[model samples]
Target chain A: MAFISRGFHGRRPSAGTKLPPGQYETTGFPVLSAGPTPRIRQDDWKLSVTTEAGKQHVWDWAGLMALPAESPTVDLHCVTKWSKFGTEWQGVSLDVLLADVETAAEHVLVTSYGGYTTNIPLADLVDGKAWIAYGYGGSDLAPEHGGPARLLVPHLYLWKSAKWVREIELRPSDVPGFWESAGYHNYGDPWREQRYQGD
Target chain B: MARAAIPGRLGDRLRWRTAEVTGRRVESATAVTLTLDLPGWPGHLAGQHVDVRLTAEDGYSTQRSYSIASAPNGRSLDLTVQRTSGGEVSPYLVDELVPGDRLELRGPVGGWFVWRQQQTEPILLVAGGSGLVPLMCMVRAREAAGSRAPFRLLCAARTPSDLLYRSELRQGAPGLDTTYLYSREAPADSPRPPGRIAPEDLVRSGWPPDFEPTCYVCGPTAFVEKTAAYLVLLGHAPERVRTERFG
Candidate 1:
């Protein structure tokens, strides 16, 4: 019967601030600009891969899990400056995805719903530790965390970690992602601590 | 679900140290300075911040960012931490943590939020309370960059001690135009004027009527929101003004 909730933190939280358990992922991940999963049902979730050469790939749930999977203990850096470290995730390595495919390109372009697209350098895309996650923590990846599938980049800034990813296109050179195109730093490195003003 | 399993040599975990808390001082009721060891450290740019995370015995953890107060390239990273009454982490950091206690920290994050003394006009930095951390980075960076632009900083604090880097601001005040506004207390000896920085006051900050200089604003949400509003009203374009919000 109240008029409204304050919905205020009083002040903006400084970078590196962490929320306690039970509070983790409470609000979901759109805050990361990591796209949300489509509202459709399980049968509706699909992933597609297109090579710059025009070869197209389409996969349903079973097909994606059929690919190899892996995980890594990594820190996720955000343009907002919050670096969530020690998060464990599971997915098929991007390297594994390209294992049977051949391409002369050295970069990747990841696009999801909500117009979220990110570019990854060829080497970064192939990190043995990096994976196309089908699950997170220990369960099937929830839709909020890109559900069924997501691209987990443990080393780079978390923004490079694309959610609800549908396509991975191989390109010849480095390209910027949506936020990067908007003023975030390119090739975001936590150790380098490159937060914004990409070169 | 369980944590997702990815693979990698966790590698050298950024050769970090517990960084012994060398000293802790009570500058004000709500503000404190903790200087820690960072010997032989690589310098960071001005306006950069460090990530400080604390974990509970239950395994729940949180990492929050703090700006570097230590001099650029200095041996230690001095962070002037302010306690927000309801803040989950900062209160513990200010009231509980002690010297010799190590903290999990990483340094100097942020890029565009920096200042280059060279090729710059007199620097204009807007900070509220501890929002001054990164602004302090620009001050140090400007000195290191050796630019001649008169560095200027306008800080809004609740009081003198609440002002995170009061001494440094005063010492560095020779060439800069520094203001300290208190929402709570005012010192009899403080040279700067006292009171809130209203939009009208910011508009009359004494610059040439036609001057359009680079301006950087950092502080709490409301401070940043209002300050930016005032700057735009004062004729500074939106894009020309940059902001970093510190809760």
Candidate 2:
């Protein structure tokens, strides 16, 4: 519980209401997942890949992770404007994730906790490779930062790294998420400084 | 066939420079104001911020976003950075960086809390400490555009001297009523304002009933969450109260 609280704030601010460096500890890391950590119940928790033709193929969590788990080290950039580099991840490449499922769709919309969603192209999510990250660095991903699994699109930006992911709704059309809908760019491209409205 | 322009920089990133710095008051403990250096600037909207990244000799880097303190009239970027005791970034910004310092910043982010003169929605801005940065920008833009949309700015600070844009806000007085809620400093016989803006206090000092004003509250996340919850309880639509929470 202490760890989870710290995710919101890692360290006490030496400056006025400002957090110190990442090296500084805030609370502690969360021992438990705050939201639902999806189960790999082949029977219940199945991966449904929807194609542009509206065809949906279901696979259990294990089946999904089993596809092509590649360990790729890449930079993870957050909409918060901080970028953490050289992180390792494992999962089926989005290309492989959709390899079995067919789609003429140009775009894909990813959704997560509290209606937060982001849209990217089928090509973008799989630009190099996207992951349904079940592990981080080397260990099973801690729940404090989305566990049991989450989507890791290494290319676009971090907000697209949906946490506490429950569903992967493939769409031929594009739509934004809670943050994106509010004012953020549909595709949060850091290089473009797609930070706010009118940007 | 969609090829992104190859960025010459290692990450293929866009960079902003500090054209110059104008020394504003050191005011008590906080260091305020620096006129930015820029070539052709992409004018920023009020309530937007820019990322300031400093790379040490060893390439150790620190970056944080700060709301622009100056209104956009094709002028320089104004930033107010407050020194935090253990802060790796803010202290360095105020003490280490010099004018013409080669820096990298990118921004003009945040859309929810933006203040646009053409929109014409009555606005209420609530800020705390250095958190007042963005709201101050909005107030200036509104004033510069000669807007008459009733804007009410309430800034809460620990001490009188702790205020970041005290003089600026006063110098370019806002058309919207501005109030300073000081928690630590007790000003002479003014109506008893709560030492802290609590739920009860906010409810008692209710928003006027005339216009369904838009409220943009930016400050510490804790303060924003609590105050927003209170404002919702006081009858403001949850969506109507747009926010940009800073930590």
Candidate 3:
């Protein structure tokens, strides 16, 4: 994107410390979806991790709940330029979910219930960087916000989080999915303002 | 139609521009339509939206997205704002801003939700509240292009007073059919009772899914979700259903 003068941003001066350029802080959570929200029941929900080589690891709701989980306070930066700070989420870390799986893939393609998919570097999912969260703000994650388990990659733009996530596929090469193929940056980093292709 | 140029200049799609308010029209008690005159404004397609930014004198700025309510006029566009209680931007745009004031905006964003004049498929547009703004462009574009494509709109509002583009919609266009549902207060002598949009309403008022109409749904989150779900449940292909959301 060509540089454009943003004029004065003197108000909310303290927010500049945490917010990325071009983003504002929002207290009320906004719901943005391309289509309808899917109602996936916990009894029918399962998450799977697949390898490009064809190995698959699946976990049902009970199994996921039994695993040790953490509630972390994180900041979410949406590609649309809203940043919600200190949001809390509870879920199993990707490190824990992928600990048993061995793969040579360098990229991960996350899939969700509504057929939404987004790609991210495999490195971004490991080492405490991400989770498949089922709780938010001390309550069960609402379906409107990608409940029944959504991928929460707080480090990147919120689109990469992949709401209602159902599967994660490890691929040998990077592959763009959904928004990535539809003009969004293949790998979104809020701080760098990598929002679209060739940004 | 050259795909309406996908709404903006490269590298400037997200860049903010100063749009001078040229005119205003009160659409309803709670809504006002603002005409913006932009320099070298890249034309936008029906169903696309722009991000309107408001900066207070103290440099406190915020922005929200609103659909373009005007057809492709090349030099200017119209954005209709509905005042939301306690909303920072909507109230200012709907009640306070004057014709000479300048507003910052960026868009014609989202290429996917647009309606191209050349498309010949039957269209089923379902709108809730102010969601009618974007779909109205499609209706206007159909008339502007002089295309006779079969088009229908189902608009749901709290009451007749809550409807936007009241006169224009009432003075129908060729091939345009509409059904108005009042959830809170039905007009006297109205045939339909006051109620929310239901599955039966979709089957009764919309093009049958077998007709393969491209469905465009826009509204508040709940309304869009429920309406689109009903469309799919009625057998419209998921891929054929397009939606835009606002709250």
lDDT of 1 at B55: 58
lDDT of 2: 0.62
lDDT of 2 by residue, B1-247 (tens): 0111111122222344544444443644756566676656667778777776555544344457778888896747778878777666666666665665544566555444577778687777878777788888888888788888877788888877787766766665645677777787756764655487776555444365346777778776656766676776677765566666654
- Cα lDDT tens digits, model 1, A1-199, are 2111111122323457543221222122323321112333557777777777878777788887787666666556564545454677877777767777767887888876545678888788774857888776888886645666778886777778787777888887777766565445668776565554522
Q: What share of the true interface contacts does candidate 1 keep?
A: 0.02
Which window of ten consecutive residues has the lowest lDDT sum in model 2 chain A? A1-10
lDDT tens digits by residue: candidate 3, B72-189? 8977899999998866567878877778887788777767787898899999999999999999999988898898999999999999999999999999998999999899999999
Q: Model 3: how many Å of interface RMSD?
A: 6.3
In order, candidate lDDTs are: 0.64, 0.62, 0.84
DockQ for candidate 1, please give it.
0.05
Interface DockQ of each model: 0.05, 0.10, 0.28
Predictions ranked by TM-score, top down?
3, 2, 1
For each prediction in turn, the share of the native Cα contacts (below 8 Å between chains A and B) that it retains comes to 0.02, 0.05, 0.17
**Prediction 2 TM-score vs. true:** 0.65
lDDT of 2 by residue, A1-199 (tens): 1111101222222443332232222332212111122223224444456666767776676676657678888766555645555677766666766666656678777654333456776777765657777788799776535666778875665667776555677776776655555455667666665654445
**Model 2 misplaced regions, further than 4 Å:** A1-77, A83-106, A111-116, A121-156, A162-168, A173-199, B1-15, B98-103, B168-174, B188-190, B204-210
Q: State residue A195's C-alpha deviation in candidate 3, in Å.
A: 4.0
